[model samples]
Target: MMILALLGVLALAVGGCVCVVWAERGGPRWVRVVATITLAAGKVVQYSAKNRRRGLGGSNSADD
Candidate 1:
């Protein structure tokens, strides 16, 4: 079951990447929308991780 879930995620990631490339080449409107949303979501997750890492150094205290 876990392997199947992993495969599903892999397939989605691959498909999203393909869609991104296709959108860059002037693909359909829906593909462009999907690619843009996927890219934005990825950026949000990336920034969230960066913020979490930055706070890990005990610098999040209110003792400014």
Candidate 2:
């Protein structure tokens, strides 16, 4: 069951990557929307990690 769930998530991630590439090449409207969402999600994850590091007393030299 866990393997199946992991595979499902992997499939979604692959699909999102394909959508991102397709959108960059001027694919359909829906693809563009998906790509935008995927990018935004990546940014959110990045931001969350950064903040988490700061909360844990990471290096203060890192730029915001």
Candidates in order have lDDT scores of 0.88, 0.91
lDDT of 2: 0.91
For each candidate, what TM-score against the reference? 0.79, 0.81
Error of 2 at 55 (Å): 1.4
Query: Among all windows of ten consecutive residues in candidate 1, which has the lowest summed lDDT?
Result: 55-64
Error of 2 at 12 (Å): 0.9
- The TM-score leader among the candidates is 2
Model 2, span 1-64: residue lDDT tens: 9999999989988999999999999999999999999999889999999999887664556543
lDDT of 1 by residue, 1-64 (tens): 9999999988988888888999999999999998998799789989999989878755756445
How big is the positional error of residue 48 in model 1, measured in Å on the Cα after superposition? Answer: 1.5
